[model samples]
Target: MNNSLQTMYIEMVEKALDRYVSTQRCNNDHVLEAMRYSVLGGGKRIRALLVLNFNRILGGAANDAMEFAAAIEMMHAYSLIHDDLPCMDDDDLRRGKPSCHVAFGEAVALLAGDALQTLAFETLARNTSLEPAQVLQAVRELAAAAGSRGMVGGQTVDIEGTAQTVEQLTGMCMMKTGALIKCAVRLGCLSVGADEASMAQADIYADAIGLAFQIRDDILDVIGSTEELGKPVGSDAEQQKATFATVLGTERAQSLAEKLTRTALDALKQLNVAEDDPLYEMTVELCSRKK
Candidate 1:
C-alpha cells in the first residue's frame, strides 16, 4: 500500500509540475530552463506527498489539492537551488547531476531560485478550486514557514556557526528543514477545512516526522554513499555543521529518530483512520528510509 500510494502521489506531483512549467510563457528562456532544471530534477517529493495524502485522508479532493502540493514542491526546489549556490553549501552536484548554479551560471541560478519562489505563491493564489481565504491562509502559512521566522532563520543560525548544544542543533534542524514539512501537512488539512482539533493532530504528526526526517538525513550523511544520497556525502562534516550524529553520537541519534517516529505513529492513530492507513505507512517508511 505504501509503495502504491507513494508511486501514485509522486506521479501526480511530477505531472502537475511538468504541465505547469511547460505552459509558462517566460521572457528569458535561460532562466526558465534553470527553473525547469532545478524543479524537474529528481527528488522524493515527500512534502507534496504529505499534502496529497493528508488531503485524501481528510476527505478532500486530491485534484483540488494538486496545485497546492505542486506549489510546496516548487518552494522546496527553490530552497535547494539556493542551498547549492557557491555562497551557500557550494556544492557542484544535486540529485546526481550538476547543481543549478553549476549547470546554469550563478546569476541565472539565483534568478531561477527567485522565480521559483514567486511561482510557488503564484500557483497557490491561482488555484481556482480553493477559496480566496484558504489560498491566503496557505500563503501565510508558507510565508511564515519559509521566511525568517522559519526555514531561513534556521539557516541563518546554521551558517553563523552558533549551534553549540544539542538542543540548539535540534532547534535549527526543526526550523531549517522541518518548517516547510510541517506547513505542508497543515496546508493539506486547511484545504479540506479541517477543524482546530484535526489541525492540531496534523501539527503533532508533522512536527514529529519533520524532525525525524532531518535526523535520518544526518544519519545517512554518516553512512550513506554519495550515490545513495544523490549528493556528496559527509557534507556536514566538510562544512563543519552541527548535526544530530555529531552532537549526540550515532546510537543516540538513531534512538531519538525511533522515538520521534513512534510519536508520529501515535498521532496518526488519533486521526481515527484505519490501522493500515497510508499516512501511517508512509510515516513508517520515512522513519526508516535509506535516502
Candidate 2:
C-alpha cells in the first residue's frame, strides 16, 4: 500500500482500539488493568492490518471493516496473554514490557485473557454495518483458528515434540502461528462478499505468507538483537523448542522464507485484484518487514 494509505489505516485502528479500551469497565479493577495492559501493549498489529487491507482490496469500506480488525487484534492479544502463562510458554516479557502474568499475576492474567476472547465475539456481533451472516462467519473463522485444530493444537505439538523432525516442526508452526493470519485474510474477504474462487486464492496467499512469517521470525530470533525485537532473543533456542532454524540451519531457513514469500506473491496473481490494491501491496510488504 501507499505510505499515506498505510498511515491512515494504522491511525484508524489505533483510534478504534483506544476507544474500545476506554469504553470497557469491569467489576474487578485488577483484572481490568491486566486486560488493558495486555491489549494496549505495543506490537506490530499486522494481523488486524491484514483484515483491513484485504477488505479494502475487495471493495469494502474501511469503516465497514474497522470493527472486525479490532476484533482480530483483541483475539490475538488474548492468545498472547494465555500463551505467556506459567503452564504455557511461561514468558516474563512481551513487546519489551512485563508479561501480563508477570505484571498482574497469573490468576488475573488468565481472567483478562478470557475477557478479551469474549469481547472479540461481542465486537463482531455488535457491529451494525456487518450482515448477520458475515458476523457469524467471522466468529466461526476465529473459533476454528484459535481452537484445538489450529493454534492450540500447534502449541500442543510444540510442547510435546521438542525434538521433532523438520516436517513435524513446520507442521506445528503452520498451525500455531499461521492459522490466525489465514483467518484474518479469509474473514476480510468474506466481509466484502468475495466469491469462492477469490477466497480460495486468498487462502493460497495466506498459507504461504503465514509459514514464511514464522520462518522469518525464527531467523530473526537467531540474528536479531533483543533490543531490536523488543523482547528476549534466542529464547526458543534456549528452551530447546523446535524451530525452522533449528532444523534447517539459519541460511537454509532464510532461503525458505524467501521462497515462501515468492509463493505468496505468486498466489495473488491468480486473482483479479488490482496491482495497486492495498491488500496486494500489504502482502508484499509483510513479507519484507524487518520486524
Candidate 3:
C-alpha cells in the first residue's frame, strides 16, 4: 500500500472500526471481547479504501462514507476469522498474531465471527448521512456479495476442489475476492448516486485489480516469507490447491498480474482520473508487492 492508504487506515478507518465493537454493547463479555480483538487485529484494509476513495472521487465526503467503509471492513474481518478456522484454512497465525481460534476458543471464535457479520449489516444500516434508498442499495449488494452467490460461494468451490483450470480459478477468484472489491466500489458510487457511465468504468477498474490482487497473492504464497507475510507460506502447495502459479507457472502468473494491472490503469484513464490519484499508485504497486 501507499502512504495515503496507511494514513487513511490509521487516522480514519481504525477509529471507525473501533467505535462499533465496545464490550459494553454486547451480551457475553468473551464473545464481545473476541469480536473486538478480531476486528481490531488489522490488515491492509484495502476494501475500506475502495469504498472511501470511490466515494470521495464522486464528490461525496469521506466522513459521510465512514459507516459503509467501516462496515465492509467488519465484513472482511469476519471472513478472515471464519477462513482461519480449523475446518477451513486451518491457519494458526493471522494479522501477525494467533488466529482467532487460537487466541479465543473455537466456539467463541465461531460465535464472534457470526456476531461481526451481523454487526456489519447493522453498522451499514446505522449510516445517518446517506439516503434510505442508498443505504438499502448498498446493503442489498453487500448481502449478495457476502452470501451464497458470492464470497461464500467461492469458498465453497475452493473447498470442494472445483477450480481445476485457470478459467475456473479466475471465476472463483471473482466471487471469493472480487465480489467484495467490486461491492466496495459500488458502495462508494451509491453513496453519491454516481452516474451509470462512472459506475461501469469503476467496475472495470475493480474487476481488473480484484483478479490482479489474487494473482499477486498466489505469487506471494509461493515466494513470500512467513516473517514478512505474518502467516505461514506454502499452504496452497501443501494443500494441493490450484492457483495461478500452479496452473500458469510463476513467470506467466507474474506477467498476467502486470497485464491485468495495465487493464485496470487503462480503465481509470478512460474515466479521466487525475494522474496523482492514490488509486493509480496503488494499482501500480499491487503488481510488485513482495508480501
Candidate 4:
C-alpha cells in the first residue's frame, strides 16, 4: 500500500493545516483554541490525502496542492464541528475526544466552525504557487461543494429525515459526502490543468469511492467498536438514521461496497496510474476500513 508514502503525505497535510490554523492567524484566543482543537483533532485525513495524491498523480507538484489540501481539511473539520452541534447531530464524542461543542461551549464551537470555513477560502485565495485562474476555479469548486446546493443541501435533507427510499438517500449521500470528495479530486485536476478526460475519470472515481466510504461507515457503525471508531458506534440506529446498512442488510451493503470499490478502481484506469499508486491503495483500504 506504500504506507510510508501515505504517511509522508499525511504529515505534509498536517503541517500545512497547523500552519493555517496557527496562533498567529486566529486573533481571538478562545476561538483559536476551539479551532485548533477541532482542526487538529486526529482523523484519517482521507480527504486531504485525496487532494495531494490526486494532484501529484495527475502531474501537479504535490507541494502545490498542499495548501489546497489543508483548506479542504479545514472545511471538513468545520463541517464536523457544526455536525456535532446541539442543533445538529448533538453527539458528545469526536475522534475519541469531546466534540467541539462539548469541549468548548456551543457558541464558541459554532464560531470556530465559521472561522475555520472562512480560513479555508482564505488559504486558497492566498496561494501564490497556483495561477490566479486556477485559484479562482478552485474557489468555485469548493464553494459549490460546501454551499447550499451541495453539502448543505444534503445536510438539510438529512436533518429533515425526508429521504425514505434508497434512491433518495443515495442522492442525499452524493450531495452531503460525495460533493467534497469529488471536489478534492477536481481541485487536484485543476491544480495541474489536467485534461478534460482525466478530470472526468477522477470525478467518476470519486463518486464510486465516496458512496463506498459512506456505506462502509454505515456498516462500521453497526459492527465496529467504539474503541476502534473513536466515537459511539450504533449511533446511526440510535438516531434512526437511514443508512445503507439500515436500508440494505449488512451483507448486501458489504457486497455493494465491494462492487463500488471495483468500479472506483476501474475508473482510475484512464488516469494511467499504476495499480500500486497510493490513490488505489487508499481506495482499497477504505473499502475494508475497520473504523
Candidate 3 local distance difference test against the native:
0.88
Candidate numbers, best lDDT first, in rank order: 1, 4, 3, 2
Per residue, candidate 1 scores C-alpha lDDT tens digits across 126-156 of 7889888888999999999999988899889
Give the Cα error of residue 66 in candidate 1, in Å.
0.8
Q: Model 1 — which ten-residue stretch has the worst lDDT?
A: 273-282
How do the predictions measure up, each by TM-score? 0.97, 0.94, 0.97, 0.97
List model 4 lDDT by residue over 1-291, tens digit each. 349988998889888888878733555688999999998889888888888888888878988888789999999999999988879888899999999999989989999999999999999987789889999999999999999877899999999998877789789989999899988988888889888889889988999999999889889999999889888898889989888999998999999999999999998877787788878888899999998
lDDT of candidates 1 onward, in order: 0.89, 0.83, 0.88, 0.89
lDDT over C-alpha atoms for residue 291 of model 4: 84
Give a tens-digit lDDT track for model 2, residues 153-265.
98888778653787887788778989999988887887898899889888988999999899888888888877777767888888887788888998998888889888877
TM-score of 3: 0.97
Q: Which segments of candidate 3 are over 4 A away from where they belong?
A: none
What is the Cα-based TM-score of model 1?
0.97
- Report how far off residue 91 is in candidate 3 (Å): 0.7
